[model samples]
Target: MTAAVLSSPGATPPSKCFTIDKEYPKPTLPSQTWVLVKVKAAGLNRAELRGRNGDEPAPPEFGMFVDEFHPDPPKILGEEFVGIVEEAGSETKFTKGDHCTGFIYGGGKAFDGAYAEYVICPSQRCFKLPQTTLSWETLGATTMSMWTAHGSLFQAAQLTKGSTALIHGATSSVGVWATLLAKAQGCTVIATTRQSSKVDKLKSLGADHVLLEENLGDHLKKLAPKGVDCILELVGPDTLQTLALPHLAKHGSVVVTGVLTKQWAMKDFTPALIPPTRKMTFYSLEPGQEEDEGVEKVIEQVIGKVEAGTFKPEQFLDRTFSLEDVGQAHEYMEDSKAVGKVVVTVP
Candidate 1:
C-alpha cells in the first residue's frame, strides 16, 4: 500500500512535512466490526497541517478532535475520504464493493487513515453513499463539509424552509454548502465574504444577496431589515457577537461552525444570552455524542439530496491532485486563497 506519512515537525517548506511510503504495510481489520476501505479520493484538511506544525506530541486524550490529534509522528494523515469497501468484518453491515465515505476515527491515529490506498475503519462510522452521478472527487471533498453544514443548519440552528439565513464567511467549504442547502430548502440566503471577487461566485450558487464583510450592519439593513432567522458564523473571531448578534431576529438561531481566527470561545459569551430561544448551548459533532444520535441520518439526508439533484455539489470542488502529488496539494492548500474544497485522487 502507498501512503503519505508525516515525516517530521514543521519545516521551512510546508510540503516537507510529508514523505511518501510506497511499501507501507496495508492495514487489516482489528475486529469483526471493522471494514477495510480502498480509498478512491480524499481531501487535504487544515487539521492535518496543524498536526504537522505542532511543537511536539499532544496528549493521548487529544485524539478525540479532528484538529488536535497529532502525537509526535502521526499515521497516514487524512480525516475524511470516500472509498469502496474491499473487505468487511463478519458482524458488519457493509459488504465487498460498497461505496462509502466518513470521518476517520482519531483523525488518522486510531487506524491507518484515508491518505493511503487502503484503510481499516469501524463499519458503523461509515456513511454509505448512494449510487449517483456525482464523481469521486466531488464526493470525497463534499462529505465532511456537507455533513457539518447539514448538522449545523438542521440540527443546531433548526433552520426552516422560509427562514432567512445569514452565512458569514460564505466562501468557506462549509459556508458554501450551507448556502446551497439553505437555498435549495427555499430559504433566503444572505452570504458574506471578505473578498469582493467571491461575491459573484456566491450569487451564482443561489445566495439571495451577497455582502462584503465590511459594514455588515449596513448590508443587513437593506437585505434583511427584520433580521435573519439563522446565522451561520464560519469566521468566528467573535463575529457571532460583534457582527451577527445585532442582526439576529428575535428568537433566532446562531451557530458558530468555524474558528478561522484561532479564537475558540467568545470574549463576551454572556451578552449573547437574551431571548429564551437564544439559550446558551454547546453542540457536539462527535459520533453518537448527542442524545438523538441522528448525526449519521443527517449525513445520509444531505448526500441523498445531492443524489437526487437538489443542489449540484460539484460547483464547490476547487481542484484535484494525484496521491503521489499530495505534497503539492498541501502546498496549494497553504497558498491558495480560495475556500473551495481541494481533493486528492488515489489512482
Candidate 2:
C-alpha cells in the first residue's frame, strides 16, 4: 500500500515533511478487535498539523490495553476517512464491503493513518455512512466537524426549537454545521467571523444574523439583548470569558467546542464570570465510537438532514486534492487559506 509518511518535522513550507511511499506495508486487523478499511478518501484536520509539527501528542494511557499504537515518526497522518470495510471482527456489528466513515483516535497524531490506500481502526469507532450523491471528498470531511458540531449543540448545550444560538468562528466547517443544525431545529442562528467576506455566505447557510468579530459583545447586546439560548464558543476563553458568556440567556448553555485562538486554558478564570443559572463547559466526543451508541445517532441525524436537503455538505467543503498532494493539503490548512474543510481523495 502506498502511504504519505511524515519523514521530517517542522520542515520549511511544511509540505516537504511528507514523502509518499509506494511500497509501504499495509495494515492488517487484530483478530477479533479491529476493522480493515479500504480508504476512498481522507480528511485533513488541525490535529494532523500538530502531528506533522512533532507536537508530541500526549500518549493515550489506554493504548496498550486496547492494542493501539502511535509510531514515533515517519508515520501516515490523516484523522477522518470515508471508506469500505474490507474485514471485521466476527463479534462486531460491521462486515465486509460495508460503506463507512469514522474518527481515528490517534490518526496522524499517533500512528499510521488514512493517508494510505488502506488503514485499520477499532471496529467501534467506524459506522455506516448515509447513502448520498455527495462526493467522498465531502463525506470524508464530515465526521470530525459534524460530530463536534452536533454533539456540542444537541448533547452538550441541549439547544431546542425557538431558541437563539450563536456560533463563534462561524466560517469553520464545524461552525457551518452548527448554523444549519440550529436552523433546522427552528432556532434563530447568529454567527460571527473575523472576515466581513464570510458574513453573506454564512447568512445563506441559514444564520439569521452574521456579524464581524470585533465588539461581539456590544453587537450581541443589541441583536439578542435577552441573551442567546446556546453559544457554540469556538474562539476559546479569550472571547468566551470576556465577550460571549455574559450574553448567555438565563440557564443557557455554552459549549466550548474549539480553541481556534490557541488558548486552550485561561488565566484568572472565575465561576463568577458565568451569569446566575448559566452553564459553560468544554466539549469533545469521547475519543472514538462508544458503547453508548450516541455517536452513531449523531452521524445518522446529520446525514439524514443532508439527505433530506435540509443541510448541504457542498456549503462547507472548501476544496479537494489528490492523495499524493496530502502534504500540500496540510499546507493549505496551516496557511489559514481554507474557510472550510480541506479534503484529499484517493482516486
Candidate 3:
C-alpha cells in the first residue's frame, strides 16, 4: 500500500512534508470493534492542513492522540473518507464489502488515516452508506464537513425556524452546509465571504443576504436591525471581535467553528465584549464525543435531506485529485482557490 506520511512537524510546506510510502504495510484489525476499509475517496480538511503545517494546535476530533510535534512513526493525515469494508470484527455490525462513509476520530495522528489504499478504523465510527445514486465523491465529502456544520448550527446554536443566523466563510464546505441547513429549518440566513464571486453561489443556497466586505457591522445592522439571532463564526477571532460580537441580538449566540485566519485565541478578550444577554461559544468535534452526544441522528437527518434532493452535495465539490497528487491538493487549499470541498480519489 502507498500512503502519504508526514514524519515531522513545524510550518513546513506540504510538498516537503508529505512523502509517498510505496511499501506501507496494511493495517490489521486491532480489536473486535475495528474494521479495515479499502479507500475509495477522501476529502482534504483545513484542520489536517494546519496539523501538517504545524501552525495551530490539532483539534481533539482528529484522533491525533500522540504528540503531533514528534511522532515516532510518520502520521497519516486525512479525516473523512468513503470506502468499502475489506474486513470486520465479529462484534461489529459492518461486514465485508459494506460501503461506508464517516469521520475517523484521531485517525491520522492517533492512528492511520485514509490517505492510503486501505485504512483501519473502529466499525462504530463509520456510517453504512444508503443505496443511493449519489457518487462516492459526494458521500465521502459529506461526513466531517457536513457533521461539523450540522453540529454547529442545529446542536450547538440551536437554530430554529424564523431565527436569523449569520455565517462567516460562507463559501467554505461547512459554511455552505450551515447556510443550507439553517435555511431548511426556516431561518433567515445571512452569509459572509471574502470573495465577491461566491455571493451568487451562496444566494442560490438560500442565504437572504451576503456580505463580501471585511467590516460587516454596518451591513448586519441594516439587514437585521436588532441583530442576528445566531452566528456561525468560521473566520476566527478577528471577525468574532470586530463583526460578530457587536451585532448579536439579545440572547443570541455565536458558535466559533473554524480559525481560518490562523488565530485561535482572541487577544485581550474580555467578558464585557459580549452584548448584554448574548452568549458566545466554541464548538469542536471531539473524539468519541459526537457518538456520546447522539450526533449520528443529525447526520442521518442531513443525509436523508441529501437523498431526497433537498440538499445537494455535488455543488460543494470544487475539484478532485488523484491520491498521489495530495501535495497539490493541500497547495490548492492553502491558496484558497477552491470555493468548495477538494477531494482525492484512490485508484
Best candidate, TM-score-wise? 2
Q: After superposition, how far is residue 235 of candidate 1 from its true place, in Å?
A: 1.7
Each prediction's whole-model lDDT (CA): 0.75, 0.78, 0.79
The TM-score that candidate 3 achieves is 0.89
Model 2 TM-score is 0.90
What range of 10 consecutive residues in model 3 has the weakest lDDT sum?
64-73
- Relative to the unseen true structure, what is the Cα RMSD of model 1? 3.3
lDDT of 2 by residue, 12-103 (tens): 67778888889999988766778889999897776677778876443441232235444354378787799999889887788898889867
Every model: Cα RMSD to truth: 3.3, 2.9, 2.8
- Candidate 1, overall lDDT? 0.75
lDDT tens readout by residue for model 1, 208-287: 89988788788798787878888888876366656777778888888877765555666766753455555323333665
Of 1 and 2, the candidate ahead on TM-score is: 2
Rate residue 305 of model 1 by lDDT.
Answer: 72
By TM-score rank, best first, the candidates go: 2, 3, 1
TM per prediction = 0.86, 0.90, 0.89
The better candidate by TM-score, 2 or 3, is: 2
